[model samples]
Target: MNDHDLLETYEPVLRFAKSERFFPMAVEHYLERCSILPSGPLGAAGLLFHLNEPLATFIGKLEGGQYFLRFINEPLYDADA
Candidate 1:
């Protein structure tokens, strides 16, 4: 995706992350780390972060205990499951 599209897509996620109710500190912590990482890995992390719980749970069925962790930790690993 283009930079503008990427930025636009993250707008809502950012808002949610900032909100006190849905405030997941781990996500914010990861964002801080992601700032220094290369774009590709950051993008993958961001994609995983945006996945809702049900979707994340579904992805976990792909031979990983958690989709977000697996996706970010082993992105290059075949997603074949």
Candidate 2:
């Protein structure tokens, strides 16, 4: 089979609970709402890239450092309540 068919055959299905409100979003949309932060010791230094910044700018900031995307900056409703 071709690469596309192989990938499709192995793709796993995602099952979400009825109460689950969050869902996957497009990378571009997610990037627009998220900021880049250093994942390790550098995290204390604060944010590396602000929300809505260009992808190139985000990539430019990643050099010899560990980073992660912070999608939600605020706390959500209490789930246990």
Candidate 3:
């Protein structure tokens, strides 16, 4: 699947892209690491442990990135650098 589709499918894991804030950590790092995850429900269960943030925040973090929040301006999309 494309990056957007892959990411959308694994929304749960992506949400924990910043678990440092006690953000929902994954049941297992293998299925949660942003650099990994197989995609779909398996990926969701991985990080669907303690996270409790709104899904919109996750989308905003992915689409808007630094534009919406500076500290969490993570790169959710492919980039040249």
Candidate 4:
């Protein structure tokens, strides 16, 4: 079988709870809604990209350090409601 067919055959199914408010989304949409942060011990916990920036621009700003994305600037769902 081809690589694509093989991988697809082995792909696992995912189930989500009915109460789940979030699901997989496009990287562009996710990047626009989230902020980038530096990870690891030497990396300070701060916002590296706080605005709706593109993935290419964000990658260019990386300085060979471990980094992660956070949805701190916005809420995925209204928990207080």
Candidate number achieving the greatest lDDT relative to the actual structure: 2
What CA root-mean-square deviation does each model show from the true structure? 16.0, 4.7, 17.1, 5.3
Question: Candidates 2 and 4: which is better by TM-score?
Answer: 2
The TM-score of predicted model 4 comes to 0.49
Ranking by TM-score: 2, 4, 3, 1
**Residue 77: error of model 1 in Å?**
36
Candidate 4 per-residue lDDT, tens place, 10-81, comes to 997889999997788776777776666667743443234435556546565555577777766664656756
- Candidate 1: pairs in clash: none
Candidate 2 has its poorest 10 consecutive residues by lDDT at 43-52
Stronger candidate by TM-score (1 vs 2): 2
Query: If both were scored by lDDT, which would come out higher, candidate 2 or candidate 4?
Result: 2
Superposed model 3: Cα runs more than 4 Å off: 1-38, 52-72, 79-81
What range of 10 consecutive residues in model 4 has the weakest lDDT sum?
41-50
Q: Where is model 1 more than 4 Å wrong at Cα?
A: 13-21, 25-63, 66-81
Choose the strongest candidate by TM-score: 2
Q: Flag the better candidate by lDDT, 3 or 4.
A: 4
lDDT, candidate 3, 1-81, per-residue tens: 999999898876434444465454343442333332224554445435425644333432332122221223365455745
Q: What does candidate 2's lDDT look like per residue over 29-55, in tens digits?
A: 877776666767665353443455575
TM per prediction: 0.18, 0.52, 0.19, 0.49
